[model samples]
Target chain A: MYSNDGFRELERHECLRLLAKVPVGRIVHTRQALPAVLPVNFSLDHDGAVLLRTSAASELVRAIDGSVVAFEADEVDALTHSGWSVVVTGSATVVTDPAEHERLTRTGPSSWVPSPQEVFVRVEPELVTGRELVGGRSLYGVDLTGAT
Target chain B: MYSNDGFRELERHECLRLLAKVPVGRIVHTRQALPAVLPVNFSLDHDGAVLLRTSAASELVRAIDGSVVAFEADEVDALTHSGWSVVVTGSATVVTDPAEHERLTRTGPSSWVPSPQEVFVRVEPELVTGRELVGGRSLYGVDLTGAT
Candidate 1:
C-alpha cells in the first residue's frame, strides 16, 4: 500500500522477497530490559522461517533462545537516494531436534565469524513489514511528488 | 580484552572510533514489549554522543524519545571474511533547547529520506562494546592463530 509521503508500505510476500536479496541483517532482542542489536547472516526456510547460526557462548544465542525478536535488513543506493528496508518480527526458537539440527548444521547461513556456530536458531515470522523510498529523484520511474 | 575465541574485544575508545567511520547504523529500541531495529543515519559528537534527525511523524522518533536504545554498525569483507561490529547502548533524548536544536537541525546527520527531518534525537553512550574477527587467512596481516 502506498503510505503517506513517498514511502510504499510493502506486503508480507514482498517483504520476504526483499529479505531474500540481503544476506545480512540485525537481530534485535531484549536483554536486561534494554534492546540489543547484533548483525547476523541468515537464510530463509521453505516455510519462510529465518535460519541462523551462532556460537553457543554468544550473547545473541542466550538472549533469543526462545523469545520474540525482530530482524531487519535493508539496501540503500546513496547516489539515487532510494532504498528499501524490511523487518520481520517473530518468535526465535533454538533448533534442538537432532536430525533437524544436523541438517541445519550442514546447510545453515554462512557466518563471518570463524567460531564454531553450534547453535541453530529459527525465527518464525509473526509480522513482516517493509517500506521503500519512492518518488525520489532517480533514473528509475518514481513519482517525486511523494517525496517527504 | 580477549575473548575465548579469535574475536578480539575492542576497547571503548576503539569502539567509538569504528562507529565514527560509518555514517549509517541500526537503532534498536523497544516498541510495546518487543524490540525493534531501524536503520538510521547518524553522526557522532566530540564527546561520542550519536546525533540523528528523523521525520516528526516517524515511529522511531516516537519510540526513542526519552528512552534507552542501542545503536550498531559493522563492516565485513565477504571475500576476506573479516570484519568488526560495534554496539552502543545509550539513552535517547530529544534536543529541546531551541538554540541547540537549531544547531543540530542545521548540522545533524543527513537523511536519505526526502522528508522533513525536524526531530533531532541524541543518544548518549552508556555501554560500548565491539568485536573484530581476527586471524583469518588474509593479506592484511591478521593474526590467524586467533581465528576461532
Candidate 2:
C-alpha cells in the first residue's frame, strides 16, 4: 500500500466525495505497455464496490478480460469554487459469478449509452484515497504522486 | 490512424506550448492492464517530439519501452475561465543511438524534482488534437487531424 506523500491525508476523503458527484471518469489501463484511457460513467455501490457499465466493443470490456486494472474518478472546480478527487487503484476483474454480477447489475441501472448489449466493470476497491480543495483559495495542486 | 476525436487540432499546438511552459506532465501507463499514472517533467524537441529522461530503474522507462502509449497534457484556467488540453497517442521506442540519446539529455533540465534519471522517452506525434474553453459560448475545439 503506497501512500500519497504529496498532500497530507486530511483532504483524502474529500476527493472521494467529489468523485461521486461527477458521472464521468477516466479508466486507465495498459495493453502491451501502452496506456489506454477511456471515459466511463460510474457510481459508488456503498457495499465496498464501485459499479460501472460499458458496451461489448467498448475498450472497457477488452481490457477487463481477467486482469488487474485501476479505476479513477475525479472533479476539479475552477471558479470561486472548490473541487476534489478520489482515485481507486485496485484489481478490476470482471464479475464472474452470475449471482454477484446480477446483484451489482440490479443495484443500479447500467450507464451504457451507445448500446445495451455491453458488459459492465465492477471495481473491488482495495485502496481508496482522495484530495480536496479547501476554502476556495487560489487553487494549488500537490504533485500527483502515490495517488493510486 | 485513429483520430483523437475530442482533441481539437488548434488546441493541439496550444497543448504543446503548455508542455514547454510546464516541465511536468502526468503520464499514465498500464502494468498488467492496470492504469499507473505518474508525475513527470518533459521537453519538446525541434520536431515537437517529447523528450524526458529516466533510467531502467524508472517506472516510465519500463512502461514506454515498447508500447503504444497515450500521453496527455492539460491546462486549467481560473482567471478568464479558460483552459486547454492536448493528447499525443503513439508508439514510444528508446533512443539507443549514443548521439541521439546524448542530444536529448542536453536539451534542458528535467521537469521532475528528485529526478528519475538516465533513460529517455520519445513520443512521436502520430496523432495530435486539442480543445479550449472560451467565454460563455460553446466549447472551442479544433481538429488538427492531418498535421504532421
Candidate 3:
C-alpha cells in the first residue's frame, strides 16, 4: 500500500503484521551529539529479529555502540485514531552466539521493577518500512521489505 | 509523589521535576548481553543532565561503553489518570569537550520524523527518581530537588 512517491513499502508479511501488536518501542540513536530515545521490551525473533533486554550499564547501550541502526515499532489508538508502524533500518550487532547465548538464556526474563541488570540486544533488520494511519488523516504504505 | 518503594530512591531535583513532565520515554540498556530498549526525546539539563543524541556506532555506545550507567525516563497517563516518571542511575560518559559540545546543542532538528542516520545522546543524572499517577489508581512521588 505504497504509491505516491513517498513510497510506503512495508512487506515481510506486513512487517510481521505490525510487529505483532507492539510490546513497546522507540530506539532512535545518536548519543553524545544529541538524539537518544529508548523504551524497550521487544521480541520478534523467529528470524524476524528485534529482541532486546537491558542492564549491564545502559544509555540504551551508549547510544548504539555497534552502530548502523534505526529501529522503530509502533501501534496507536488514542481512542480510535488508528495506527501501525514498523521501521527497522539495519546493522546493530552484538549477540555473540553460544547457541544464541543459550537461546537467550531460555527466554524468560524481563523486569523493570527494582532491578534487572545484565544486558543483551540483537536487532538485525537490514531495512523494513511501514505506515498505516487510516482515519485520522489517512496515510497508507506497505511492502517495504528492503525492496525484497 | 512516591510511596511504592519511592521509585527505589530518587533525587537530583526530584529527578529534574520528573523530567519536566515526560512526553514519552524508554531508554533501558545492555548491548552485549542483549537487553536494550530505546524511544527517546528528552530534556532536563541545567546541570540536572539527561540530554540526548547518538551516532558514532550505536548500541548506546555498547551500553555506555566506559561504564557506570543506568538511565531511565518514564511517562504514563491512561487518560486523566495522569503520569510522571524519572530515573537516572548515573555516570555514562562520552562527551568529548568541544566547548562542552557546543554547549549542549538543542532547540531544533526533531519533531520525530528523523532518519538521516541520527546521532547524539548525553545523560548525566547521577541518581534521580520520580513517580506520579493520579486517578488511574494513585501513586505520587517527588525528589529531583523538591524531596518528598
Candidate 4:
C-alpha cells in the first residue's frame, strides 16, 4: 500500500524484520498525563516482542509498567533521503517471573548502564506498522516512474 | 542533576540547544487511545516550538491537532556508546491563521514530500527534559573519574 504522500506501507513481517535490524529505538508512553519519549537500546524476541533492559528502580520502569506504549526504530540516509521506520504499539510489562528473568538476563539486550538490578520490559507487537520512503526509486535503485 | 543509572540530566536550555542540532525527530501522540510514534523532519522556532511541515490531509494532522504530544530528537555514537536525547512535551496546533501560515510558509522547514497543500504544525515546548549518556567520560573526551 502506498500513502498519498508517496510513502510505501510495509507489511507486518517486513516491519518486524526491519525492526530487528536496528539496535536502538524510542519508547513513547504517558508521563503525568502527557506523552514522553526516551531512546534506548533494545532487541526483538523470537515472537517479535520488544525487549528492553533498564534499572529496576528507573523512572521508565515506574511509568511504563502495564501501560500501552509505542516503540519506534528507523534508519535514514541523509544523502539519499531514503529510510524506513517501524512502530510497534502494545502493552509494556516488566518481566517478574524468576525463570523468565533469568532467561532474559542470559539472552536479552545488554544494558548500556552496568547495573546489577536491571530488569527486562517486554512490549508485544500487537499493532505493527511501517513506512518506507524510497525517494522516487525502488529499493534496488530502479526508477519507479510513479508506479510504486 | 543525575539519575541513579548514571545518565547525566540536561538542563532546559541545554535540551533546547541539543534539539536544535538535529533535523529529524520522533513525534509521539495518541491514536485511538494507543500511543503512536512517527519520524518527522522539524525545525525549532525562535521561541523553542517545534515546527513540522506535513500534508494538511495527513493522519498526523488529524491525530495531533490541539493535543498534547511529545517530540524527541537525539544523536548517538554506537562505537563510543555516548549520546544526548531531548524530549519536548507540548500542545500541537496546526497553523490556521493566514498571516501565520504565510509567514511559516516562507520561513519554516521545507517539506520532505513535494506537496502543494503542506501546512505547518507548531508544538509548544511546555515541558522540556533531556538526558546525556556520557560513557564514563566528559563530552570533551576528558575522564570524569566519577566527578561529573
User: Could you give candidate 3's per-residue lDDT for residues A1-107 as a string of tens digits?
Assistant: 64542334467678767786665555555444333444455667776767666554544555565886656665544344345556676666556666775677577
Off by over 4 Å in 4: A1-4, A136-148, B1-5, B136-148
TM-score of chain B of each: 0.82, 0.74, 0.31, 0.86
lDDT tens readout by residue for model 4, B1-108: 766444677888998898887777878877677777777788888888999987777667887899998888888675577888788888999999999999988888
lDDT of 3 by residue, B1-148 (tens): 3544323344456557766765334454444433344444555567776655544454454556455454555554333434445556556665676666566555411323233343445666665655443433312111211122
Summarize candidate 1's per-residue lDDT along A27-128 as a digit string, tens digits: 777777777776667888767788887776666667788899988887755556667878888999989899998887677775555464467789987777
Model 4 agreement with the true structure over A30-125: per-residue lDDT tens digits: 767777777777899888899998877767788789998888888766456678888888899999999999999888887765565778999998
Cα lDDT listed for each candidate: 0.70, 0.54, 0.51, 0.75
Query: Which residue pairs of candidate 4 clash?
Result: none
- Residue B44, candidate 4: alpha-carbon lDDT: 88
TM-scores vs. true structure, each candidate: 0.83, 0.55, 0.27, 0.87
Q: Which portions of model 1 show Cα errors greater than 4 Å? A: A110-117, A135-148, B1-4, B111-117, B135-148
> 3 or 4: which has the higher TM-score?
4
For residue B112, give model 1's deviation from the true position in Å. Answer: 4.2
Candidate 2 lDDT by residue in tens digits, B1-148 = 2234333335556667766775444456665545665444567777777666655455456666777666666554433334555666777777888898777667733533233346567877776655554423211112121122
| Candidate 3 wrong stretches, greater than 4 Å | A1-20, A38-148, B1-13, B16-65, B68-70, B78-82, B85-89, B92-124, B127-148
